[model samples]
Target: MEAFPRAILIDLDDTLVDDSSNVDACWDDACAAVAPRLRGVGVDRLRAAIDRRASWYWSDPKRHRTGRLDLRAVRRHILELAFAELGIDDSGLARDLAEMYRQLREERAQMFPGVIDTLDRLRAQGVRLGMMTNGAADAQRAKIERFGLAAYFDHIIIEGEFGAGKPDRRVFEALLSAFDVAPGDAWAIGDHLEFDVLAPMRLGLHGIWVDVRNAGLDGRPGRPHRVVSAFTEIVETPV
Candidate 1:
């Protein structure tokens, strides 16, 4: 995408939304909540189990399409699995702890600094806008609605609803088709190098990495067309 691109697809979560503090807090709370019930189980051990389960869950893209893609469900599964492994049988406690984390996560989402202005400016320029998120439909929709994002995005695609996640060309194609824009006339901005940038790049859409915290891009063959530290930087130049 170049010279006033026609469309921009954005990733939710850590990209456009700031949820970092909540992530840590959620884990801390979950560990604490589950520890007392499980007796000898340490918070560190439960956290490690969550991290391990999260890695496994996200790596397999197919798992995202299933209705089981509810993030709370994933955490609940992690808690349940960990409890079972430790020979503790209290499904109620595990479910409650996981639900607690999910609520904290939903309550903490906010736009990254300058993200709203950037999006507004892009929309004012007549650039078609859309959201592509890898989450359950209801979970992702809550964040979108909580932030009043419905007016900004012309289309929204949640992997759980759409049956495909990022790094998949189909997601890009669907957005392109919806906007009636050619690939060269559109761009994608995301915090994720591989999923947000590389995936769109593969389909001929300009991919810009929005690494607000200066996170280094990982080694990947599908290079981003542009790299930016903040949304303000992207809008300053208008793509």
Candidate 2:
């Protein structure tokens, strides 16, 4: 743990980038689009309903679409389900709202504090850097291009392009293999405990989970190596 890792892997959303900012805006757009259908419900109430339904759908660990590799389909499905819950079972309406949300969200995506500097420093130190994120091709690529993030990474592996996702040892293994680095000589960091940290830990990589939400780590195994509340901690000593 004293030596720096030879290769480094990082997550996209909430780790190196603050994707929620645009996601919130996208939800605002969705609310505006659905306001007319809310008969008696307030905009705030319908927004909550849609968010809850979408969250419920994506929170299913075993659901294939939860990986969000196909953002268009998954998001459309989420809105469709939400509409059904609100007695507005119109697929066309759901599709339009989903497309609107995605377009706005991608246009407004922003990186987290110090992401560029941190990645630059790591790359300067000869650390092999890779971005292993689960997202749709266009949506995820838009973020990389919008923020010029591709300059910092030696590998940009999106699950949509790679055909695999985290928690699957194959995805973790394939990354290290591509870099020709052993798991023990690499580190993987992300916002999600299981997908980013726990899975990598099992693969012999030093997995660090950035719990930006202040989620307590109690009762979980300490194999994640480290858990911090900020993204800047990635550059700290012994990372």
The global C-alpha lDDT for each of the candidates, from Candidate 1 onward, is: 0.79, 0.79
User: Candidate 2: misplaced stretches above 4 Å?
Assistant: 21-25, 37-41, 64-67, 89-92, 219-222
In model 1, the worst 10-residue window by lDDT is 64-73
User: Against the correct fold, how does model 2 do in TM-score?
Assistant: 0.87
Off by over 4 Å in 1: 64-68
Measured over all alpha carbons after superposition, the RMSD of each candidate to the real structure, in angstroms, is 2.7, 2.6
Clashes of each: 0, 0
Give the C-alpha lDDT of model 2: 0.79
